[model samples]
Target chain A: DQQVKQNSPSLSVQEGRISILNCDYTNSMFDYFLWYKKYPAEGPTFLISISSIKDKNEDGRFTVFLNKSAKHLSLHIVPSQPGDSAVYFCAARAGNNDMRFGAGTRLTVKP
Target chain B: DTAVSQTPKYLVTQMGNDKSIKCEQNLGHDTMYWYKQDSKKFLKIMFSYNNKELIINETVPNRFSPKSPDKAHLNLHINSLELGDSAVYFCASSQGFGEVNYGYTFGSGTRLTVV
Candidate 1:
């Protein structure tokens, strides 16, 4: 069974616009959530993370919001640039070091 | 310099052969892990080691073994490789053996193809 899921397989947004990616998880025990951006032929690089204690976390142009009751999270990027185009993965970790990752959403920032 | 590095970016071999994938982390972390991404792009943990001791061992085949020569290195060796084993293997590291704090750093991944 998939613990984490990204319903959208792909998304497209115009440059300078806002891009939103959504993810959901079935495991309520997950207390830590992370978002990673990956380019082709490269490993995923950490973008931002949110602790279950807080509802939202923002860094620069990126913001991550978590809704524990809904078991959902979203990543928002304002003024999306072409450089932001890549595959984004949502991951959740429980008490132990065990982590589960989503299938990933491919983002296309058109210039 | 790369914090996490894996050798043999691509591996191609016939079925029933044996091969090894080497991983190294220079971040001075005490924990290392191995994850596999299959054709469907699903990433799953295979094994993890802390201070050269096995901490987490997922339900993997017996043919697969993870060896940690030291805290900084974790290598995966596959015996009698099967076609189902074809996937992208990534090596990662973290400071502690818990889910909170000390985020994981992943390597570029080694793509293994079994023909």
Candidate 2:
């Protein structure tokens, strides 16, 4: 069973607009959530993360909001640029060192 | 310098063949991990090692084994691979295991195909 899920397979947005990517998880034990950006033929790089204790975390133009009650989280990017176009993955981890990742959402930002 | 690096970026072999993927990290981190990304682009943790010792082993099959010769190296060996084993495997390293300060640095990943 998939513990974490990204319902959207792909998302497209115009430059300078806002882009939102959503993810959900079924495991209540997960207390840490992270977002990673990936390019083709490369490894996923960490973008942002939030501890369950915090509802939101922001870094520059990227913001991650966590809704503990809903077991959901979202990443928002304002003034999206072509460089922001990539596959985004949501990951969750419990007490153990293991992390579960959702199927990535391919984001395409048009000029 | 690459924080984490894996060898043989692409590997293709028969179902009954055996192969190994080598990984090394220059970050001097105490924790290392092996993760598999399937065709569906779902990433799953397979194993974790701390200071060359096995710390976490998920529900992976016995055919797959992870060896850490030292804190800087972790290698995966698959015996009698099957077609279903085809996937992209990534190696990552972190200073801490899962604490707030632990942020993973992943390798470029090795894409393995079993025909």
Task: Using DockQ, give the best candidate's number.
Answer: 1
Model 1 chain A weakest lDDT span, ten residues long: A92-101
TM-score of chain B, candidate 2?
0.96
**Which of the CAPRI classes, incorrect, acceptable, medium or high, describes model 2?**
medium
Which ranges of candidate 2 are over 4 A from the true structure?
B100-102
Give DockQ per model, in order: 0.69, 0.69
At residue A29, give the lDDT of candidate 1: 91
lDDT of 2 at B19: 98
What digit string (tens of lDDT, one per residue) describes model 1 on residues B1-115?
9999999999999999999999999999998999999988988999989899998899999999999999999999999999999999999998886534546899999999999
**Candidate 1, residue A105: how far the Cα is off, in Å:** 0.3
Docking quality tier of candidate 1?
medium
lDDT of 1 at A75: 100
- After aligning candidate 2 to the native by TM-score, how far in Å is the CA of B27 from where it should be? 0.6
Error of 1 at B47 (Å): 0.6
Give the alpha carbon lDDT tens digit for every residue of A1-111 in model 2.
999999999999999999999999999999899999999999999899999899999999999999999999999999899999999999988776678899999999999
Supply the DockQ value of model 2. Answer: 0.69
